[model samples]
Target chain A: MFQQAKLHWTQSLHLELFQNSTKWHTLYEESYMDTSRPATQTATQAPPQAQLDIDKLVDEHYDYLFGYALRYFRSRDQVEDLVQETFLAVIEAVKSFEGNSSPRTWMIGILRNKIIDRLRLKCREAEGESIGFEQDLLSHLFDSVEHWISNVGPRVWGSCPEGALKQKQFFSTLEACLGKLPEKMRQIFLLRELDGYERDEICKTLKLSSSNVGVILHRSRLALQHCLQVNWFEEKKARGPQ
Target chain B: MISCQRATELISKRMEEPLSLKEELSLKLHLFICEFCEKFAQQVHLVRSAIKNGSTEPDDSDTHASAEAKERLKDKLKLRS
Candidate 1:
């Protein structure tokens, strides 16, 4: 009888949680609809053609920039701000955009300098209290990442079981996985993989060597694979048996 | 056996683009012979696909900056322009 009662209570709690999640999903969808068009209008004021160019540019590149900034700032609030700043800088500097590289490449080049500038300012404000050398910083960054990846485990991958539902879940998991990566590795991965920059361009833009970029990307991928396999996939398998 | 080290390098390149015919054949031949390497390859492929289809979409909120921030940045750029 106690077991039955306990089961009832637990089921009720899950139902409540499900209802709340549905409510939140509705709220999120509405918020997206309410804000998206206006945001686009005010964000880029280029003419129709230029607007199209900017739209394509943003669609293709924004995630990479957002992810890149998120790694450095380690905060979502600042991610959008940094991305907006990056775009505004790109727009203002568009006249000087020589088309020497892909738009994504050029924007990321701008973003790298912006990030370095921000970091230097941060270091200055901290007043040489020892933010540590670049190598040390990178090591610390990866150490935390390796730790997180070990904890998060593997991810689930398959055909989307419930259409958009699966896609959203996958994306949410992907974002969380990205958050777990070390700052520099995350930056390099997003810049190279997500943004479609050539390795040479990534190395030049980030002032990293080709070898360094390769090492960072390899580690990032391994960590991501491990996180997915352990966290999402194995857990799903366990649940499936029950 | 494809060492994890070599597999790591090839995995990076594969994500960017499929391996060349010769390289692809070599990788497949290795996978046919090595269960662990095959699993590793499948996992790498899964990660690549996930990222490819993933939401690199900009957040909808960033469509517009705060008016005040926009003006400030514009003025600053104008000075340089």
Candidate 2:
């Protein structure tokens, strides 16, 4: 009986080891797959390794880089063009990247300059000084908010018990609601909620008064609440039964 | 005593920042006495949370980038040398 008990323990130990080994192997395979893709197929045509590295850098950071562009341009269609422009600039300045920061940060810095240049071009095309005035006002307003909010403790909403899947659902609903907002109000909402701009800064940037900013924000939030209530909560309630 | 409308405005603004001591005391006192207003406040809070936690699927336009455009961009980048 003792011998049989010892054998059973040994068998269980072996099974546990086998399961752990399988998990480790699965993780290894996943990491390998993730890293195996060449950063940029475009760079494969380039003869130089450094040029290839720069191309790879651009490819890796494309999503967030485009997101930043879309934030400024407020148009998804413009994002691709802006990203292309950013890459072109990066390629030209590849040798000068200096490695002073992480490649992502350096690429973002280049993209920032490109965005400013594009904005300036748009300002010129508008055939009015309003754009320049708005930009100046925006910068000042944002600086004030940054000073105020930077020191305040980060806001934590209630803990999400449902995990990442639910959180993602929440984000998607918010995004849709945001997309449905009127153009000016949507821009203001994004600037404040997503970008963390202060109300004063938003008013100055958009060339509106504090009351105007408040009105727009208030309306935008109300609209979003209405949208979510109708689309998410009501649907859930209906499916849940009386 | 503040009217319901004034109380509602103050309640919404208070959510955005720390309310003044007097404002806080007023809201608390009002909330204690008025069940309807209390329920309204709670509903508003629920709606705010729903909005904050909301998610929706990606639109069709976002789901599939034109493969042709991606190929064209790739070719254009390849030609830049």
Candidate 3:
């Protein structure tokens, strides 16, 4: 119930991607249109044909950027604002773009940095697991020397349920399992696994040390696996000698 | 020999970053002797990969961008008309 609401609460809202009117405009015009730049001067540059189409760029990549930003922000306004900021940034920086990285890579890198800046300003709850969650919950899972307590060790999941990936129940179970995680750990897991963020990138974005990222990731993985065991996996027949 | 405890952390860490050679060797040895830990490592990898591209809850709303947001970005990009 609570989990279901959280899942739906994060729903992505989008209408059919019908191409809105495509206006043929140069970067000089569009870039200046948004700002106070005098509109008449066309800067000397490679032909517009050679330069990437600003309209095409936004049209093609908006959804990717939107979805990526959506991962970090639940607010529709926030997501669009970040995306708008990113598009503006991309155009403004396009002249300086070295063309070494692919356009998508460059744009995403910009978005990532923008998100971190937002994170810093927003001062969202401190990242990584809370000390209380650590001292109370995690300490109970391990001993003083960092060994799993008996009966708390990992268990056999036996055979994974067939066709589970095709089933909605599996994702619901996954969503519920994810909801049980500490906020920071859940974000770390989603960023690292689902969003495909590299460890150092995640560390920088969340403002955590690499090793701290490792710890949070390790614990998140453990909790997720354990959660799956109890909630979904262990229900199946076991093949191991009990 | 790494304890099952530390060995498990290394299991998850290896997913995000490369393990030191010594750490890697210890993990390989621990996983070799401990079937449960070995299975645990594999299962973790399975879940990560599934979440990456294979797993999908198509019914979820946020997976796709809102059309209004798209229009707004186009407008902000100065897609005049």
Candidate 4:
């Protein structure tokens, strides 16, 4: 079991996000799942074979799982529902958990599956969100003939400094930039970049055609690159370079 | 000839899956002449890794799940398990 003290930064950031944000729902208002279903609706009646410490697991990982789910969903209700669903699944599957991985990792695997299931349900509704704004973003970055515009073209960020990834400030900036992405785009980008889901899995899970997934991923990277540059790299330049 | 826009798309797509022979050649040719697109490719790589690290690594922020939310989840778990 991971100790509570060892878990710190990401939990706090996610706590703040869940408590204070209402804009979380605006991004997918029409498609937010009907989370009002009874929490027991999905729990299996299978008896537990292993003596997994459920309370201790919740104590250590609830916030981390909340934060992880926040990446896929910003709504507090939805995030809570997903975490609950994951724990229920954990209870049923605890018998098969061979301890090859840490409990946290195991729970995360289950939580991701829950998230994918939620996405599959949403995709079934076929809301077909209007991504026309993505076209405007392309025009803003390119000229009429599809060449990069001077002011908006990608700039040299110089080489990544040693241990840049270990820097907390860098992660915060990256998180902010990721938050700026449209929810759908962010969902696809993270499924690829963070969850390490294969592109085919993403297309199948999200009910998007392969080309549509490609286009969304492209737009997301473009947006994230611009946001990171403007918020992190450019700010560093203004401070007279590191 | 692939435009700079097309080159950037291929750059992002290559990260997801392999590009066709024509796409691979055009993107390579575009990067050969286009310093900006070359920089764009590097930036995409940087962004991808940065995100992977930023998300996976635990940090020192002083927050945890609210007691209320935790309690609620516990209650639900008790009901099912």
Candidate 5:
């Protein structure tokens, strides 16, 4: 397990982002996940003196922002910072905020920009430069006529106990496995899977070709499925007949 | 008959836009014989549904925005108002 992930798991995609183990994380503010107090409580707990509507807004939208932020970042601290930064930005921009997009969606758009800036910073840093996007990754998964290479194709996950997904550990594993993906693939996957963005929109936002979007999306799905099958679902089989 | 790779690619393409009769049939036929691909298909469905559901649920982890952070933002916003 990555050192960042070594700490007690707080939630899915726990704090092990792509940081190198050798250096201190002083590049940004120090923070950690604080699930001890549910955000809902914090939002509603707005002091008696706080404006009522702002409290309501925070109460209503904080979880959605927090959840969306978690999907992109592995660190609890980064997630906390992003959500806080988002609301801060919202206060200044809300006045000019065209009601063109729904408020939550608008907030998410701002949050996405923060995420992109962080990722771009990571990109500039020399140590974390490797994105691990293997060019041959997909080709090996298929044969000459595009059939799966039988020796390493997918297996039935025993009908995939959909009910099992409700447990929190599933998200932990899912996020960890997802965190293993190349950053670009991760971005496209989350946009489609979490935000439900269509291909055209993804292409426009990411400046990717439409076909590139599809290929990356498919490849990401394959990688996540393979990871889950190995780490989670296949574990069930491993314990069978034990 | 389309290969599993072609069929899977077509399957994803179908998500983005409508597939032609020829493309759709080719994929369906390939999926029929390809049990593994069938499983892959189902897995994608399961994942998409899971994400949709997961997003709606509250934080199940130990980390969330701190109350201090919330108050801080509110104080700043109050100044803006």
Candidate 6:
């Protein structure tokens, strides 16, 4: 009789948690609906005259799209698949293009949504393994007493360049470092940094605790700063005269 | 004095939300004396700015799509069109 009561309480607890999560999912989806609904609704029967020149579009934008997709997917085939999906989405949604933005910008907007949808699915699938990645990285950087190790501590990076992001070499090196991050860490980092999602919003969207998001973001920044210092700054010094 | 690890964590945390007065004061005190942590704080700001500016779009000079992938996509679109 006692076991039965305990089981009933646990079941009700799960139900409450499930209901709260569903509430989060609905709230997340509602935000997407505002931006994504219109183009998708009209996508089914795009006017024939609205047909985009697929060949031209591919020739012009394929590189940019491919490079962008590589940020999320490592394998060339997987990246190709994402780019293909983006173009297909563009073809379907072209009629709804309001000419308010350039074609490149519009396609980027579509591809961004597609990437987010894929990430949302991935987040659910990898829920268990989310936060513990690169715990060793933190320890390796610091010590048992929560102090940075002597040999592994940060170096002075000098001044940041005036137009650092505009430089292709620096940006590519940054992308490579980002690619080196653990998958879940990279996801949360990008969602916060690149996509500009708020902390609470990220907690809801990825179904992580607020503290977990904070830890992941903190570790990711540490790792990334180290990577940039090594790959970009030190390497530049090595190649140049003092 | 807080350890550098704790100081760095607070430094990153401050980016997400305003730190408590105690946290802010401790972190500020730590950064003031520790050259490495000070450099680290600057790098964090630099990296955050770089990510914000760079990653949203593909750079023109970055890697481009292969011909085969483009051809394959074009062929697939042909069937749909």
Runs off by more than 4 Å, candidate 3: A1-59, A94-106, A120-129, A135-180, A189-207, A231-242, B1-3, B16-29, B51-59, B62-64, B79-81
User: In CAPRI terms, where does candidate 4 land?
Assistant: acceptable
* Residue range with the least summed lDDT across 10 consecutive positions in model 5 chain A: A19-28
Q: Interface RMSD for candidate number 6?
A: 4.9
* Residue pair clashes in candidate 4: A9-B59, A9-B61, A12-B63
Candidate 5 regions off by >4 Å? A1-64, A74-81, A92-132, A143-146, A159-161, A164-169, B56-75, B78-81
Candidate 4 achieves a global lDDT of 0.69
Residues A1-242 of candidate 5 have per-residue lDDT tens digits of: 12222121122212222112211111113322233554334222323332224665676677777867776766778788888777777665543332323455555567766775565555334233222454465666777777788766878766436755765656666767777887667866877877566888777755667887788888788777777777877776787733
- The TM-score of candidate 1 is 0.51
> Pick by DockQ: which candidate is best?
6
C-alpha displacement of A181 in model 4, angstroms? 1.4
Which pairs in model 2 have colliding backbones?
A138-A205, A141-A201, A169-B55, A170-B53, A170-B54, A170-B55, A172-B55, A172-B56, A173-B55, A173-B56
TM-score of chain A of each: 0.45, 0.50, 0.54, 0.74, 0.57, 0.70
Tens-digit per-residue lDDT, B1-81, candidate 6: 999988999999999999999999999999999977988888788778777655445554435567887898998987886
Per candidate, the number of residue pairs that clash is 12, 10, 8, 3, 1, 0
Query: Which sections of candidate 2 miss by over 4 Å?
Result: A1-49, A52-55, A63-76, A89-168, B1-22, B27-65, B71-81
Please, what are the lDDT tens digits per residue for candidate 4 over residues A79-122?
A: 88888877877766654333323456556667777787777776
In order of appearance, the predictions have TM-scores of 0.51, 0.53, 0.62, 0.78, 0.66, 0.76
> CA shift at B8, candidate 5, in angstroms?
1.7
Q: Write the per-residue lDDT of candidate 1 for residues A1-242, one digit (tens) a residue.
A: 22332233333332221121111112111212122343224222323333224433455456666655655566665766677777777666554333323455455556655665565455324432222433453353234423222233222344432232344554656567777776656666765665445777677755657776676677777667666566666666677732
Output the lDDT of residue A76, model 4: 71
Question: What DockQ score does model 1 reach against the true complex?
Answer: 0.17
- What is the C-alpha lDDT profile of model 5 across B2-81, one tens digit per residue? 67877777777776799999998888888888887887887777777666666443455544656776777667656665
Write down the C-alpha DockQ for each prediction.
Answer: 0.17, 0.14, 0.45, 0.46, 0.36, 0.50
lDDT of 5: 0.63
State model 3's lDDT. 0.64
Cα lDDT tens digits, model 3, A1-242, are 22322222122112112222322223234332222334443333434444446567776678777766766666768888888887887776665443323455556667766775776665356643355665665676678877667566666554553355665655667766776776566666776776466889777766778888788888777777777766776553343233
- Among all candidates shown, the one with the greatest TM-score: 4
